[model samples]
Target: MTAATSISPIPVAPVGLTARARRFVEVDSVRVPRRGLGQHRRKWIEHGAPAVEIDRAAVFQDRWGGLALPPAPFYEGGPRILGAGCPEGSTDEGWSFRAGSCRVSMAYGFRIGSDGAFGIDAYRWTPLHASTDGWVESLALAAHAGRWAKTVTRIKGKAVESLDLVGFEPVPEVQGVTDTWWRGKDSLIALYRGEAVGLDAPRCLEAHVYGGLDEWGLHGG
Candidate 1:
């Protein structure tokens, strides 16, 4: 028998899985909606007054990455990009990425002043097609909240003198679920669940300021 020459198969880069295929956690059942400042602005207007002008320069004051935000371990001095998304610049923008099974959108705006007094309004949204399980929705909500907390920590750092859980409102479909939080002298956390309402009816999570930034928390100076 003629010895068969061993032929190595052509090396092919493995195809990356889609967001849905790589689902490993229950929260992954839901899909994150597209990102856009317009959607967030519409929602803010519908609920109340026009959205505040986000200070892009201030928000990324400590950021080191180029266009896309990097993932944690966040930048030591400021907010770190968590993953690939839109480039930073506009006063308002949307960031979308996968966190476990949950698709998260950190649609936010900010206004930091010379005195360090600032306001940050961050809105989290998921697609209505997300898992209908109340528990799942809650988990997703918590995941997004956690991410937001880290973002706040990175940006405000020790400069945060006082932190607040300003607002935690859910979409109409998820209004039944009550979101709650705890505000200590330095830290605060809010958790809840709801449908991802579009511009027609958008929910918000906001924080107002009384003073300025501290070494690691908001303060009154």
Candidate 2:
């Protein structure tokens, strides 16, 4: 899923889901109207956002704007992805703008330095992925694994440290730096170390195991 950052053409991104999004959470994909972006851009300019940067942001919104991803364990405790329908001004962008937020209004946007990597606030940048597709890929992975795993377990704080992961391999598609997904023979473990680091609370460490996955479920059919 290569996201193009251009304004002349209406940026189009694949809806990123098939017929199965309803399995784990009922996901609604809404198309953001291009006409509304003029006002969104005007708002960004008043906030002193750079034009090229704003255009890139606007282009991203034009493409992947309206799909709100359901929250997983480590996500912001609500829908992690924003379905805001338009870009909103934020001091967090430095020169760009913001679009997504969770329960605490913790903002998420594409990073300019990383050429549009999606992440949380400006300070932490991306605790998520190297690109927008990586974010979508993570959601897809979570949905697929969560649906098939017959037994689910959640652990937090110091208990996360005791997990034995000798045979578990990191799921590379997430492109995770701090948080990661580990796939074992029959279990997929989502380890969220970034949460504790971001909030300055060690007890925020979390890990969820999707156990009882068969080969089909583990790798997807």
Candidate 3:
């Protein structure tokens, strides 16, 4: 009798059983609207005649942009990145100013055209950078403010002793967490993780406690 050979196939699992978890800490993308400086600046002026500045060397606007001012960080000696935060989302320019101590994560999407605008998003951990020191919580909030995450734009003081509060905002949709050092201007400005929905809302946003930043080895400074 001839020897018989046998072959076995590998087992397969069902697709539904192996689907990804849809509700376990989802990070939505940030949004950037098409509005320009002339449109959004009005809000800042209404709040207070917040100073605005536009960079000439930036890629987005040659000389036609304004600051997306928020509030100043409670502490001094913050971290700042040049050419970030612009009004019209573009691949050209952006600016960010972060003082105090904070940890921030940012994400943005883009599209190109004559009248095109992109989406921008950011997430922050209050007292994010503990080693940075001073108002570590507040600093993290300041750094991740909507004003800083949208576009690469910059603002500077005309004089040496002026207080400049650079700001950023999310595009009305994405959401996450936000804690309260306080809320809005005149508030303590703590990290508030949450989501953005419709230019003035936080749809599915949430926040965790802000404490023991030192345990993360980020608050010793």
Of 1 and 3, the candidate ranking higher by TM-score = 3
lDDT of 3 by residue, 52-161 (tens): 33221133332111211122342112212112233332243332222112224323221111222222233421222211111222333434442233322221223211
Model 2 lDDT tens row, 25-118: 2332333233336666777677665667667766766655554555554555534444333333445544434545455555343332324555
Q: Candidate 3: where are CA atoms >4 Å away?
A: 1-194, 197-203, 212-221
Question: Positional deviation of 153 in candidate 3, in angstroms?
Answer: 34
Task: Give the count of colliding residue pairs in each prediction.
Answer: 25, 0, 57
Candidate 1 ranges beyond 4 A from true positions: 1-132, 151-168, 171-175, 178-221
lDDT string for model 1 (1-221, tens) is 23343322221111232222122122233212213334344544464432332223213222211212112121111122111122222333342222111123434322222222222223433332122122222333334344334344322322322443455233221222323333344443333211112222223222222122232332110
lDDT of each: 0.27, 0.60, 0.25
Top lDDT hit: 2
Model 2: clashing residue pairs? none
Lowest lDDT sum, 10 consecutive residues, model 1, at 74-83
TM-score, prediction 2: 0.71
